[model samples]
Target: MLFFTVFELVAALPYSYSEDLARTVAQLGALAHCSPEVISAWSCPLCKKLPLTNPQPFGLPDFNLSGYTGTMGTRLFLLFRGTEPESVINWIEDLTFEMVAYPHCEGCRVHAGFFASFKALRGQYFDRVQQAVSAGKEVVVGGRSMGAALAVFAVLDLARTFPEHVRVSYNMGCPRLGNQQFADWASKQLQIYRLVHWNDIVPHLPPRTLNYRHISREVFYDEPMANFSLCNDSG
Candidate 1:
């Protein structure tokens, strides 16, 4: 199969990375791992200061996949948590890497596990995100690890519905979510910042040899918590 990176898939566009937005969304991604009560209460340090409102957690009980959605000022935010290290089900889902057709786009396929996880609870939060969009709110979706993979699906779906309204997505330590077609399709849809921290092995999972490819605009950090470099989409 022919592979297409973001560079070959889409035209060059003006892109800028914001440290503040990344930090805030990173906090939100962490908060996604919290309980419903903690999410509703906005108990985190950053949450205490941000004008985050209408926080609600959604998930599938069987899979233990969960996340929270809320509005921060005019931005509608959806955040998903990564794999639960202790949950056998989550690990099972993460390991199930069979690629399947992504229904929302033609010739686009994604990780079966991530797509299944997204489809399970998509209804629970999709309507809320739509409502926010109807009110003219910009959309911001994020997640970490497996959740970041899910965020890729969510943002692409949202972009399909309200193309201009879906602004940006912040995915930290995210693995490759789909095939070349899907990655190419997603790159044209919105701004996807795939943040890779130093030596995180999770991002390399499922193997590129299996035809799975990551989306555009990779932000790679060399040190543990310090500096980072914006990588090209050649891989």
Candidate 2:
């Protein structure tokens, strides 16, 4: 009975259908080649200038939850790094297919490998995110690929605890994170802009056969002429 009630609540969520090409490119670049030193220089369609200079950067020191925070017009951009080819071990290990119930939200499931990586930074980094919100900054969590998947879980947890503080989540080439119910619930809580490049295979990972579904609001960019379009949740 309770599960049915939750399903009803999630199914009522609406999907945003729009495309922002500039943001798609910028975020993809940041995911590939960004650091604390030059994060402010990263521009997007939403904010011409991120203004993240001298942001407070933190991570688990030995984990992938590494990120930074600073004001972008009263909003804080918390961006994570994707699986780097140089980090061969992390990249290879995170390909596992075990799906598990995410403890932070009811009816939410996530890749077990990504969730384990998230746990390493959950305590300290999560506190820092809370502090950033307490300082009156809206949070926008984002990433690409594996980092994008991590950001999905992080944003869901943040929305569950500090819904008012969470502004949105922007991910590029994000892999499938959870079930349809999880995607529906998350779309209701925050605006999730998932950007995909032409033939970018990362977003199709884990396969729908495993019950993996991407969150809604996808922006697709086709190369050569650089055409862009928006699609529904299934895209």
Candidate number with greatest TM-score: 1
Model 1: per-residue lDDT, tens digit, 126-233? 889889988999989998888888898888888888888886888887888889988887887778888887777778876899998888788876654556667658
Worst 10 residues of 2 by lDDT: 1-10
lDDT of 2 by residue, 1-235 (tens): 0000011112333433223423533443363335544454545443343344435555665554576555556666666677664663565555777888876568878788778876765664677778778988887777777777777778877888897887577777788877777777776777777778777778888789988888877766666424555665663
- Every candidate's CA RMSD: 6.0, 8.4
Instruction: Tell me the number of clashing residue pairs for each predicted model.
Output: 0, 0
The 10 consecutive residues of candidate 1 with the worst lDDT sum are: 1-10
Provide TM-scores for the models. Answer: 0.87, 0.75
Q: What is the lDDT, from 0 to 100, of the residue 140 in candidate 1? A: 90
* 65: Cα error in model 2, Å: 4.1
